[model samples]
Target chain A: MTPKVSRFLRDAAPATPCLVVDVDRVAENYGRLKAAMPLARIYYAVKANPAAPILGRLVDMQSCFDAASLEEVRLCLDAGARPEDISFGNTVKKESAIQAAYAAGVRMFAFDSEPELRKLARSAPGAKVYCRILVGNVGAEWPLSKKFGCEVEMARDLMVMARDLGLDPYGISFHVGSQQTRTAAYEAAIARVAMLFTDLKDAGINLRMANLGGGYPVRYRAEVPEIDAFGAAIMGAMVEHFGNALPEILIEPGRFIVGDAGVLSAEVVLVSRKEQDDPVRWVYLDIGRFGGLAETEGEAIKYAFRTPHDGGAEGPVTIAGPTCDSTDTLYEKSNYRLPLALDCGDRVELLSTGAYVTTYASQGFNGFAPLAEHYI
Target chain B: MTPKVSRFLRDAAPATPCLVVDVDRVAENYGRLKAAMPLARIYYAVKANPAAPILGRLVDMQSCFDAASLEEVRLCLDAGARPEDISFGNTVKKESAIQAAYAAGVRMFAFDSEPELRKLARSAPGAKVYCRILVGNVGAEWPLSKKFGCEVEMARDLMVMARDLGLDPYGISFHVGSQQTRTAAYEAAIARVAMLFTDLKDAGINLRMANLGGGYPVRYRAEVPEIDAFGAAIMGAMVEHFGNALPEILIEPGRFIVGDAGVLSAEVVLVSRKEQDDPVRWVYLDIGRFGGLAETEGEAIKYAFRTPHDGGAEGPVTIAGPTCDSTDTLYEKSNYRLPLALDCGDRVELLSTGAYVTTYASQGFNGFAPLAEHYI
Candidate 1:
């Protein structure tokens, strides 16, 4: 078990099936990111956790925010973040939300399509808008498909359209993808952004800022390169591509800033064998896929489990959530193993579960309340 | 478009991404079930959709409730359902929840394992308990896998254990699976239950009730047999297996009771082609996996979509939720087609969505509100 989790388990004594976020660890993760990319301004992605305390901590640290909606902008503002420090990162947005965010003083927004640009033009005139260009999301654990960004030609046209619509064609942005691990992915995306910047300039729209959208990875079950390594690769690519004309760099990181700082302490609800001779023990917990662990999408993201009896004999186990729903099974095909001695009422701490949990929780599915969150 | 959806769209100009439930249709579906299965007591599965209005309507129809948690028990009770009329159907439950349900005057419960039996014995002594036996879930649209039910041998032992622990082993139950279309699956499950009933009787335990757990299929993309067809099959099997000594029959139907009674009216947020040569138009809706409609798991359950321009030229399209997450894509691989003329702000109503859409909603992922439900 990591010392962070051990300390949390010892000190917090949190209710079962609750998330315990360590604000100290969050500060440390922030420090690490700042040290890695000193020149780049950090915009904390609010979608990852959106817990009030986490947002408050980030605001206290003077961190800018990447707000996806008007509600998110309100959350950051409530947490003491200035509207000028918030960027509406979602390219596809409701016109009402655009007007609301603009009314609340948010000036930076992202758009990838002409319709979205038109909505922005009507709702928030003269706002600093960025065009997201599509790039390969190779080697990312959660590779974002073609959902947000547009092609380079379309992005160039969109930038010109933004200028024509009386909006600030302020920047170019591209997401390598969420939980991205490869340094080359950054190099390729930065190169694409450089190409887009030159093309937009040729179209008489000189962008002033480049938003390197969030994709920075966090260490889960697998080993990820150090934060410094990602910084070095990004800095090297920016210098190689843009030389003296590098736009002001900005990063919107979600997981890397908060993934490691949180730990989930869920209780073992039941440990039984469906068949008497079955080798794998089914370990059911109070929390499941709907209870904030949706990131276990297809069991692709394996969370490290720690039990009180960690030193005991280990045996193969299929972990499941407590819901009656069949899809709530956490890890069955992954050959997950746990201490043989684990039983009902025993606590199992899932590590690195800080990000993408709370916000994904269902509203009392099967009569069970949403996962409780606690910050220490 | 279905007449129900058209009427709803015409009368209720509800906000985008809202669920419109037809209570009259709910009454009709309930009446159909009653006419089909006259002998079986209807225990409305509250997990399908725990909306207050639906529960109140069910309560007025004199429907028994299959509550999965204490909160559900409370919901049913609040909706005017007698505590005696509610069954705690979820086998895996927290001891505190069991205690709360018992204290709330619930005497009927279900158990599958020894640990659970012990918990029930302590929290709900003398309660009417049913042992769920594992059965094949073939030909089920939503096969439950092994998340619920125990093998026959283990269930037999657990029943005897329940008797020893001062809990009443009052019945045997088995779910063929949710959305079960095959009549043979019910026959096979009933035969196994009959054998268990005889075995328990010989062991000096007279099981007085039999629960044919919820698995009734709903018509979505394909046609389903009428409620009478399922009732006839179940009645024929019960009479064939148990002869004249039939126990009190109980059923917990969730989707079948409410599935067809509701329509989801989601607005088109965006309709764009991701790539230049891509023929598939990506249609984004305000509601996605997080905003309910999680039943689209693995793209297994295909929901029928209807637009205002249903008679217009149809084109291949991929449906997606409005969340920033890539996994929120709903129907990329499902060969979904929509009206080619559909654009942003146009409404597309998802049929047969009343049962599983509302309660399964995530709590505002990506800063989007949960899907609103309006009863008409």
Candidate 2:
């Protein structure tokens, strides 16, 4: 067991399994992305972390909002994002959801099929449409291309149908995939969308925007392409294909906006020996599946068990959570040093959990309390 | 794409991401276990799905609640579980938490340490203690024995300390591990606990219960053991080892109680081609890292993706959720078939999601909503 330890942020008091967003880091991330995509309008994906305070700050940063559901739109709209400044990007939407989006004043939406276009025409009269396409992925194993994006043939049909309905289907959009490891995917995707743009223009539709759907990969475990270099490659492709005819650019980067800005802080509860012939030990933390890194089951990143403090680093101890469930383990092993002895009430901080952490918390146990926000 | 279809208990109405438990299935599950272990006292591990109504139902099943925290104790109390019926099973606990558990009227608690004994004595002096033992795991890659249970040698010492403190240390407890695949582990654990009974008696401490702990596996996939048979083996071991001296038995069963009873119904929003040169497709559902399934990164469990209305099942599709993050995928690849083509707004049900589903959901895009509870 590691000895008694403390976290710098919780030296005063501790809140277990809560997310703390470093507001300064978030602003810096937004600033860096905004600077690189000077010609393209950036929209923060609210699905990452939609805290009202975070939403308000992003709005202040002049970033538009991207929502996936009616409830998401409502939350962003309530947080004071202009209705038109919001983009309802979920392609497979309900009729009532489409009508609600229309009533909520969402002007721009993405469509991946002829049925989607037809439904939009019936529900929202003359909504501006962007034909979302399944431009072949570069190398990332993203599921979006198969799940939501329309094929090239279907994209053409949807675009023509939008024109027939007298709706200004003024854009071409394709998300390469999230956490894209290579920049070539974006380049290839942009080239494909460019071809679609030319085809749409030949059909007498004046496109106004080229939406490079957001899947700007954050370098989670490994190095990814730089935003500037990747953007430059895509922009160069847009200029080569459409020249002056290329529309204004829009990108919907979700994780790139806020992923690294948040951290989940938990406390150590007990340190005990593992079962069997193995000589391993364990340090139980307060945060488990209910915390931000819940997707890792009990363990998220390999380094999730990596503790920052050397003094608190104890012997090789597997970490578990406070949940009574058998699967409530946090780490199978630890690489970092832990305190030689840790009693109850010690803290462990889970790093780099800002993007999808707090928003995915289950409120089923003890009324869900929002993580306390501290802006520095 | 399979033609639009439907399935049992779901309609055209969109089902939310997290799994919904059939109250009937839950009641039946409890009834089956009760009938099998007629002499054993079941302690429902509330960490699986600690909603108030779920706890209330368990109370009616006559099962006591096993809580890890003071808050969980309060939750069981709020759901009308008598304090005496609540067991604080967390080995390493806070002083305030101990007081809270005591105040909440919990009488039985698990003790893991020499220091913890003094703390529990100062806070919950009247509470009965269960000396948790580190009886090495049966056959698990990772076990809870690493984090909570006391060493076998320490268990003897702690029992002696409990006696010196004038506290009625009721029994010894040990959890094999979650999703434990070995039945022999239970037999071995019972043998160790039986041995400990003699050790504690030699120390002049009379104990009356043996909590073999809860790591009873659930059939998340087709490969798990039958619950009925496993129950028989465990009971047989208890009778064999303890003979007439078998203390009142207690077991904490978490996922095994509710995992199979729940299904997460989601909407299939988009289906597109995987961009690779090879022909592959992606089926995106409206679920993600924080939605219905919480531990995609840990263990790989097959999700039975079915469309509502009997949509004819299609090719092997990789299923993903709507979160813009790359890691938000649900199933890497599946051989699922539906009745018809799934269009926009078509529903997909992810089965066997009852255990760690909403308990880990964070309201990322929209806030968490309550699940519907229907009586059998």
Lowest lDDT 10-residue stretch of candidate 2 chain B: B1-10
| Candidate 1 per-residue C-alpha lDDT over B1-376 given as tens digits, one digit per residue, 9 for 90 to 100 | 3476567778867787888888777777888998999999999999998988889998999999998778899999999999999999988888888988999999999878778889999989999999888899998998887888889988888888899999889999999888999889999999999999888888889999999998898999999888899999999999999889989999999999889888888888888775566778888888888899898878878999888788988889888888888788888888888888898878788889988888789988988888888887
CAPRI quality band, candidate 2: acceptable
TM-score for each model = 0.95, 0.80
Q: Where does candidate 2 chain A have its weakest 10-residue lDDT segment?
A: A1-10
Model 2 error, position A98 (Å): 1.9
Candidate 1's docking class is medium
lDDT of 1 by residue, A237-260 (tens): 999999988789999999988898
Candidate 2: tens digits of C-alpha lDDT, residues B168-270: 7889898887667788988988898988888878877788998877777766545777777888899899989878776898988877777667776666666
- For each candidate, C-alpha RMSD in Å? 2.2, 5.8
lDDT of 2 by residue, A1-376 (tens): 1112223364645466566666656777888888877888887777777777778888888889888777778888888899999988777566677799889899887777666677788887788888887766666534343556766767876788897886778788888765566767777777788777777779876778888877676655456688888777777877877787768888888778777676666777665553334456566666665544454542434333334455554566666656554465656643534666655666666655666656555555433344554433
Which candidate achieves the best DockQ against the true structure? 1
Model 1 achieves a DockQ score of 0.66
Interface RMSD of each: 1.4, 4.7
Native contacts retained per candidate? 0.61, 0.34
